[model samples]
Target: MEMRKEKAALSSQQGLNHSPFHTQEHMRRVPPKEPQVTCRSNTYPKGFYCSWHLQHPTYIPTDFEVYVQHNQRPLEVTRDEVHKNRCHVKFPELFSSFPYRVNVTAVNSLGRASIVFLLVVHYHLHRGLFGPTVKPDPPEKVVAKPVANNARRLEVTWNSPSTWPDVETFPLKYFLRYRPLIRDQWQHVELSDSISHTITDAYAGKEYIIQLAAKDMEIGTWSDWSVAVHSTPWMEEPKPITSTTESDIIPETTPGPPSAAPRVGEPTAACSTLLWSTHLLLACVLLSIM
Candidate 1:
């Protein structure tokens, strides 16, 4: 029995010396250092995620394992495909007073290291845990101008906030508020998914104060109001013209003379008188001649 024990111990030592993983150089390799882990609830009550990175490299390929516990019960963890160092877990119960404990372990052929984190879930404190908390900044460079030919309409335009990195992934909606300077009440309009809007009910020729605010369509809080701008509805003032030259004023014309009238009466009487005067003159001539 003693010989058999000694032979077994000798065989184990020989195997360790000859093993590829137990080589002198490989045994000298450093073990993976403890990872730095951070956990946050992205969309409160919906889910939470954790990310970890090694404090120091172990000079060998390493793999990560994430484990979550709630009230001492193990919860399932899902790895994020896009982020190799990150993993996500769903909330079993929202607003639970019990804390969640997470442990992340980094393993290599040489050795393994681990880190642990404790998180408390609160609904109100987590502003945008249902989605990303990255809210767009207030719309910048906002301008309000009256339409050129519209007396009661104003056109407003603005550019998207610069802080919003991805517009395609997270579309935004807008709210426009305006009121005449003399009135205390304000009129507001919500735009579905546009950066420009036309105010069709503005008081004609009145000066108005206009402002804009924006928010993500799926998540996040609305941004603060943009800078206020003052503008008035378009109006055309009447212009008078003064005539300084005589050519500009037309001259009045005088009436023409009356036309002569044609002979209408005493035509028969004048013919008879002419015939009797001829007969008398003929008789006197005959007497003189005789």
Candidate 2:
């Protein structure tokens, strides 16, 4: 009987010990992790920093910590309040060979920290991110070369820069500006998100001074203007042409002679010559017939 009682007591002790662990295990379920950082471009540009974004996550971010390391050495340290569960960090010193990491810790009201998730930061320092520095290209050569016969339009071409860091996309936005040779005022044109542009609608054969600059939305900074270029359109002399040439070149033409009477000295040289020749021929015929 004593053995039976002792066995019952042992079983009771075992049950009591198992209940606490079972309840504790059931109560503790890990919360979901925060989202990862994302970028607008795949590659970060040279001499520029990148912005990393961590948006809303499974849990609300009330307080947070960020630690950035380069070559496994801490580079940046920051803390922020949670709003939209988003954070942006700019690393101006990031370069191609620099291997960097970021770890984020999120805390709850109870003061518990979630396991740190690692972030990878990449750069193109020595060699460009994707391709070799696009040949350290000089801004396109703008000679402002003057063309004969006042040239009316400007055609521009540039050598691709030696380094175009990889971004989400390319053929980025280009900015152009110019001033007429005679005017001190400046005129500007924006090529809505394109890398190349042809400037027309300019005075033909006129001397123009122009400038250009470019940037990628994914990239952080705008590239310097290509070498300042100077160009002049070849001046074209006015020429007289037949009606056929006029009709082809000029879309709108007078269907008939002008209704307004010619004023004194207004008759064109052609009209005056035709009138004089007709009178001379009539006088000659009268004399011959006589």
Candidate 3:
């Protein structure tokens, strides 16, 4: 089992190498978009972090930089453990202030596009232009499954993002969106401080795509939507029909009446009439003999 898992991982990693970025068609282009830096504190008063990403693969050795800006001192960025395009910066300071400037740029072999977010920023004004809180990371480990025996119900569940250190102290609310593959519109709902929800009105037997976003309860903007999870509502299985042979059949029978016996469920008068007819027949026989 472990060997099979290793082989599967290896196959996926190798597939990454087969991308067009690895080919020699074109290389070394200027960064397409400016970096839009988002720095926020999921755990307030303790510290805050900033993270940004390269829009697309560069095909060459690439690195990211996040600066303190005011002091021109470069803030060290650590690459995320899972996502290579993104990097992280941890700062002991905090903020909520007048909008600060952010510059984002992307250059790479996969150069389709890039963009910069020129919105609010700063280290220590005690509140963003919008509010005191900031958008938390999106929900994690999202799962969507069909409810058993319910063709129109879908159950979904997820966990708080790991970036939020104190879930018990500072709760998070969620927004869920889902749509079936056949439709373009999405159905959305707000789940207050809950990690699970049931979509009771899902189309029966239809496959659905679901995603979730999170924010600090009562404050802050919503995070980006989480990765999508797909599911299908339940459908009952058809029952098999069994065949019966002659041996399994019992033919119905009717016995001949003895002396005109009354049928079952008949009135008691039927039995009396049968007896009177017998007596009249006997009398007629005696007269003939005389």
Candidate 4:
């Protein structure tokens, strides 16, 4: 099966190289349409690749050739088997200001056509290709603390990734995610050109899990999230009592006699006076009777 597949691929390549419909004389009589070419660098200092396709079909076997020139000097070009119409070229220098000139030519039994592309060496070109591999390292020493006197705010700070060598040239943006320990959903914030951020909507007095990640502003993937940190917002303490305030809270009182009841007939002085008067009245009545 493998041998058969290989044979089939070779046959297809041969068929694309030559067409029976048009002879050499007929190819000279008719020409193919211009070929469209696109080139991009996937890795800086390594190389770039270019791919081309004809704008119109010529109904004949066609061949493509890619050529690259830098600073008026030609560079070596190699065919890419993955893409029959694509080719790769290595950079002569790591960082060169010279622009690259790429030409793609399509030739067939019917005719020949060509197109050109000029690539300028800029930061964007390098970033677009190898941005994933150039990711910044995770942020360092991430810390989260509650803002003083604020129950719903947390302050987070971190230093730039130590692995990133050129911070000035390629500034990094930050992504911070936080969530309460009891919650499954996370709240995220994006910070540009900042090392510190204040979360104004944190859950009051709740322990929160926090982390940070960073990436180049214009290119590269975000670095792995920084080591997680835990923090809860500050809670106000109960107020203390003062001398003046305490005095206002207390009420004044006067002294009072014990609430004991007096004996029924023990109003001794008044009761004795009444009994004497009654005895005198009785004696007067008896004398009258005699």
lDDT of each: 0.80, 0.54, 0.70, 0.79
Better of 2 and 3 by lDDT: 3
Q: Residue-wise lDDT of candidate 4 within 113-185, one digit each (tens)?
A: 7788887665456443332344566899999989998899999999997656557756789999999999999
Clashes of 3: 15
User: Model 1 misses residue 167 by how many Å?
Assistant: 1.0
TM-score of each: 0.42, 0.35, 0.53, 0.43
State how far residue 58 of model 1 sits from its true place (Å): 46
lDDT winner among the candidates? 1
Candidate 4 global CA lDDT score: 0.79
List residue ranges in candidate 3 displaced over 4 A.
1-66, 69-87, 91-133, 245-290
**Candidate 2 lDDT over residue span 1-290, tens digit each:** 99999999999988976898866764553433463443222223433222333344333335555665666677644332554444434444534455445555655553434433334433434433422212222345554444344366666555444455543344455567887788888788766444455566667756778887665533334566777777776566779776675547857766897587667878787998999999999999999999
RMSD of each: 18.2, 20.1, 15.5, 17.4
Model 4: worst 10 consecutive residues (lDDT sum): 126-135
For residues 115-158, could you state the per-residue lDDT of candidate 3 as single tens digits? 44333443433332234436787899999988999999999999
Order the candidates by lDDT, highest first.
Answer: 1, 4, 3, 2
Q: Give the candidate order by descending TM-score.
A: 3, 4, 1, 2
Error of 4 at 265 (Å): 43
